[model samples]
Target: MPEAYLWDRPDGGVPIAVAASGPSSSALAGEYADGVIAVEPDAKVLELFDEAGGGGKPRFGQVAICWGPDEADCRKRVLDQWRWSPLGWKVNAELPGPDSFAAATQFVREEDLVRTVPCGPDVDKHVEAFNKYVDAGFTHVAFVQVGGESQPDFLDWAERELLPRLRT
Candidate 1:
């Protein structure tokens, strides 16, 4: 009965999506799932998915960003919270756990974070970072704001400035 009820819902069935990182998983998602969720704006992954019959399906991506009133503070937040980002997917996958991640990323500096994540109040920087995903064929993108307490501020800024530019 529960299954029947779900199937009878007004909005129709919920679409299934698979989170994919590498080539095999990306192709599998194309063959088996309605969509794919990727950690980065990688065109190669999207190409693999599409070649595996995922054309026209939603391609979701997640990008990390640090936004704040001060660029220096935003960069600091990225270094403090997301220093491991520049390690690349291979290194991150090889790390066993949080402690390993901490140890592995200890040497990563603010400049590295800056190179990977758009940091600060500069709207153009954030937009440029997001556009990479779009250019990579991502139909949807989610921003992982690095600073925990600044979510509200980020949302406000996104609504006022970020979204507008992105629309055009």
Candidate 2:
């Protein structure tokens, strides 16, 4: 095969994966790709992906998780950094600029963010958040912290507190 004409990857080649919003895209991923990077944490998507692919390879998931030592601070941080996330898929996908996203999410409340984003310090809450994807058939996970947290501290706390629970 010819060398990849575009895209960058480590070691000169990338394991291609599919970004799927639902069953249709997941089906395509299942058929031809290594795995699906799901945006929505829905078990049915994984089932469809596996079924379409005629059963397993690897299933991975990415979930936006915002947390801190303090729940209130975590909520505020989530609001400041990810308020636009609640704009829904259509607006989020079609919006061209940060201004559009900001304007679109102007009315969103912090409480509502809890529904879609894991925003708080409760260890169980965070564990449950990740478990939702894992239970849905994801073999791996992407813990994206959107709230501009101290990465080292977050990782430390997670390793000590979060990782243990998730492992079990």
Candidate 3:
């Protein structure tokens, strides 16, 4: 991952997808005007603390950074409450990337310096998911697919399908 991320919020209500890791924390903050809650794999807890939980104005709420206590132990915590968790509603299982709670938050309101790569689906999938995010409320998103044969196709598809729709 490049350790930097960006998301656009057109509707300004709810973000589309949550990525993963500390780099994407800003998006999480962007999603919440009040506060942000983060859920991550146990392996990434320390990374998240160092990246997002540090000192600053805090993005979402006054507290800004609220990390899940258990880390890996809190999969249910994320699935049940996190906005992106497809628990109650019919969320497109096809995500923009690794639907990590942290990533979801990072790509919402503010752009952050976090490495990210395209995940989930091919170019068509990316377009659909990105458009879905925008239509739903997200205004920010980028094609960050890492080293892969499909990278160019992903970008091309974005320009052809996604950009046209986004154009005012």
How well is each residue in 68-97 modelled by candidate 3, as lDDT tens digits? 223232232323333342221123233445
Q: Which candidate's TM-score is highest?
A: 1
> What would the per-residue lDDT of candidate 1 be over residues 1-168, giving only the tens digit for each residue?
555643365485678888887889889999998999987889999999998889999999998988899999998888888999999887887899999998998899998889889988999998999999999999999989997799999999999999999999
Candidate that beats the other on lDDT, 1 or 3, i.e. the better one: 1
Candidate 3 lDDT score relative to the true structure = 0.35
Give the worst 10-residue stretch by lDDT in candidate 2.
Answer: 84-93
Cα shift from native, residue 45, model 2 (Å) = 1.7
lDDT for model 2 comes to 0.79
Question: Candidate 2 residues 1-168, lDDT tens each?
Answer: 597587656885667888776667878988988878875677887888888882767777888888787778877888888887666554677799988887888889999888888866788887887888878888888888875546777888899999888778
- Report the error of model 3 at residue 2, Å: 21
Off by over 4 Å in 3: 1-127
lDDT of 1: 0.90
Residue 10 CA error for candidate 1 (Å)? 8.1
Total clashing pairs for each candidate: 0, 0, 33
lDDT preference between candidates 1 and 2, better one: 1
